[model samples]
Target: MEKERRWTEKYRHLLQAFYFAFTNGYARGYTNGMIFTGKSKYLCVPGLNCYSCPGAIGACPIGSLQAILGSNTYRISLYVSGMLALFGVFFGRLVCGFLCPFGLVQDLLYKIPFPIKKKNLPAHNQLKYLRYVILAVFVILLTSLIHDVTGTGIPWFCEWICPSGTLLAGVPLMILNPEFREAIGFQFFWKMGILLVIMLGSVAYYRPFCKYLCPLGAIYGVFNPVSTYRLVIDKEKCVNCGSCQKACLMDIRTNQTPNSPDCIRCLKCVSACPTGAIDSSWNIARSKFESRLLSEEENSPNPEVTKTTLLAILTIIAGLATMVSTFKYNLDGVLVYHFSGLTSGRGVLAYMLVTLFKGIVSFFMIITGYKLFINRNDENAVHRFREQTRMILKFVIIIVIAGIASLFADLSLLSVMFNAILICPFPIIGLPLLASAASSTDKLVQGKGSAVLWWIVFVLLAVVTSYIAYISTVIILAG
Candidate 1:
C-alpha cells in the first residue's frame, strides 16, 4: 500500500512537469531573441503565461483582455471573454493547479528546504479577496478609463504589477536586448521591486500572489463552485477525521467544504483521505476507490534542504547586483543628459533631479531586498524599515525641491549648498539608518519629531554649504 501511494505521488509530479515543458516548448529564441509572432499568439492560453515570453506560443488571457479594453477603438471582444468563461466553467482552477508555469514556480518554491516554517498570518483570510479587487480595478476599470481619457491606455497590471510578466517576459527580453536595458528607467525599477517582493513572499507563503493579487486566478476562482471538473466528498464515507484538511496546502477545510474557490484542484486532499472518501469527479466520471487506505503518517510536511531557497536568494542578489552595475556603468554616459543640454543652470538642476530619481529607485530596490531575504519573518521589523526608508526618500525629495526653489531665488550659493548636502547624507547617514531599521534594537530616529528635526538640520547644512560654494566660485571668477 505504501509503495502504491508513493508511485501515485511520483506520477503526479511527473505529469505536472511534463505539462510545464509542453506548454513552454517553443524555447528557440528564449535568450533575448524575437518572441513567437505566429498566429498562435492570437489565441489566449487559460493561464498567466505572457505572450511576450520568447518561448510562449500562446497569449495570456488577462493581457489580451486589457489590450482589447484599452485599444484606441475601445473595442470589447466577446470571443476573448467567451473563451475565458468556457475554460473557467470546464476546468475551474485546474489550469492553475496543473498548467500555469508561474503556479508551478510557486509550488516549487514552497517545497524549498527552509528551517523557518511559518503558518498563515493574521488577516490572511481577508487578503484572499484582494485578487478580485485587482481584477475589477487594474485589469478592467483602470484599463478602460485610462485609454478613454488618454487615447493611449497602459496595461496597468501588466506594466506595474504582474510578476509573471516580469519573470517570463521582462527579464528575459531585457537580457536579450542591450538597447532595452539601456532604455530602462523608473518604470523598470518599480516593476522589479514588485517582482522581488512577490518572489520572497512566495518563499514563506504558499502561492501568496495567487491568493492575493492574481487577477487571472481571481477570474477562474469564481467558477470553482460550479465547474464540471470538481472535487466531491462522499458524505457517507467521510468520517470527519480531518486528515484531508491537514494535507490541503490551500488551507481549505475539506471536511466541511470540498469545492472551495481557493482550491487549485491539486488533489493533495484526495490522496490524503484515509477512508478513500474524497474523490475527483468530471461530469459523472468519478475516480475509482482504492482497496487500501494510506496511513495518516505520510501526510506530514517534509522539511528537507532544497535548491528553491538558494535560487530565490540568488535571484534577489542578482537583481541588486544588476541595478548597481547599471547605475555605475551608465553614470557618466547617461543618455538623458546627452539628449537634453545642461548649458543652463536649470538644465543642470534637472539633470541632478534625474540622478536623484535613480538614487530613490535604488533605495527601494535595497529596501525590498532586505525585506525579502533578511527581515522577512518579523512583521514589526519590516514595518519599521518601511517607515525609515520613507523618511530617507522624503529627505531626498525635499532637498530636490529646495534646489529648484533656490534656482528661482538667484542664490547660486544655495544651489551649491543643496548639491553638497545631497551628496553627503545618503552614504554617511541614510545607509546607516537602513541598517539600524533592520536591527533588533537600534532605532534610526526616536520619533516623528526627531525625524523632522534631522530634516531641518540637513536643510540648514545645505543652506550654509551653498553660501560657501557660491562665495568661492565668485572669488575664483574675480581672481
Candidate 2:
C-alpha cells in the first residue's frame, strides 16, 4: 500500500480505475450473461470511450452524437453537438486532461522510463479536426446513406474504429463469457487488432487518437479560447525560458499564448514556471477567493464556505451507487425480464408525466449549459438568462419532439415511472463525475448514514424489480 502512494503509482491507479471502468463496467457481461444490445445505454466518458461497452455507467457522447445524428427523427444532432460545444467552451481540452480516463491511460503510458522526444506536432493538431469529419461522415453522411439504402441504422464506429470499446468491453467480456467467446468473429478480431496497434503506439506517442481523431476533443477544443478555467500568461513577465513549452504534453507553448485550442490545462507548465508568472484559475471568483484564502494563514486549513457540503455528499453517494449498480448489472449476471402489469393504456398517462419531467430536466440542463457561456464579467441574471435563451424557440422544438417520442413508446406505468426517476440522476451524475475523480464533499466524512439510506433505496428498488421478474418467470414456467 505504501508503494502505491508514489506519484507514478497514483497515476497508475488512475489508469487502473480507467481500465476497470472500461473492462468491468462496459465489457463484462452480467451474471445472467446477456449480450450487449448495442443501445447507447452507457454514458459517454467525455474522452474516447465508446458507447457500445456494456460496462459503461453512462452514455458515450460520441454514440449519443451518432444516434442523434442518425435518429429516426432525421434532425441534426443539435442537442448532443450543442452539449459538446458547451463543454468545450467551458473547459476546452481540460475535459481530456482532468476528466477523460483514456487520456489518463496515455498519461500513465507516457510516464514509462525511456528517452522521450517532444516536438510541436502542429501537423497532428490539424488531424484533431478529423473527429469532426468522422462525426460528419460516419455519423451523419454514412448513417444517412446506409439507412436510406437498407432501412437500418448502423453505428460504423462501434463496429470498426473505437479501440476504447475493444480495450474496455470486448476483450474482458469475451474472456469471461463462453457465449460471448463463441459469438466473436472476424470483425471482433479486426477491432482487437486495431486497438492493439493503437495501444502499442500510445506507449510511444501521447494520445495519437485524441490528437488525430476524437470528435469530442474537437468539439471541446472549440471552447478553449473562452473557457473560464484556463492558462493565463503575463505576456509582460514571460522570460522565454521555453520551459513551459517543453513541459506541455499537448505541445502548446504557453509562453506564446495559453489560449490555444490544443491546450489541455494539465498544469505542467503552471507547476514548472520558474518566474512564478503563470497563473491557472477556474473562474474569477474562485481564483480571487483562493488567492485571498491562501494569503490568510487561518483560512488555509478549511478554505471556502461549507455551503454545498450536503449537496456534494449526496452527489458522491448517488454517483458511486449508480456506478456500482450499473457495473453489477453489466458484469455480474443480472437478469432483465419483461413484466406485464394490470395497468395498460393508463400507463400512457404515467409515461406522459415522465416525459414532462424529462422535459423539465432538459430545461435545467440547457440552463446550466448556457450559464457557462455567459461572460464572467457579466453579473446580472437578466443578461445570463437572455444569452442562454436566445435560441429558446429552437429548443422548444427539441423538447416538443422529445416529448412526442416519449408519448409514442410502448412502455408500462411502472417502467415509465422508473425511467423518469432514473433520468433525474443522470445530470446530477454527469456534472460532478466529470468535474472530479472522487466526490466533492467536505471529505470530513460526516452524514455517511444518509448516503447509505440513498443506497438502500436503490437496492430495494432493484430487488423488487428482480423479484417481480423472477415470480413472473416461475408462473409462466408452471403453466
The lDDT of each candidate is 0.67, 0.57
Best of the candidates, TM-score:
1
Measured over all alpha carbons after superposition, the RMSD of each candidate to the real structure, in angstroms, is 23.8, 17.1
lDDT of 2 at 110: 60
Q: Per-residue lDDT tens digits of candidate 2, residues 20-117?
A: 46533633344434445544454344566554445555566777777766666764777677767667767788777767766776666765755754
Number of backbone collisions per candidate:
3, 21
The window of 10 residues in a row where model 1 has the poorest summed lDDT is 302-311
Q: After superposition, how far is residue 437 of candidate 1 from its true place, in Å?
A: 77
Cα lDDT over the full model 2: 0.57
Considering summed lDDT, which 10 consecutive residues are worst modelled in model 2? 329-338
lDDT of 1 by residue, 53-131 (tens): 8788888999999998888875675878998999999999988888788888888887787775454545978988989
Clash count, candidate 2: 21
Candidate 1: list runs displaced more than 4 Å.
Answer: 1-9, 148-150, 283-479
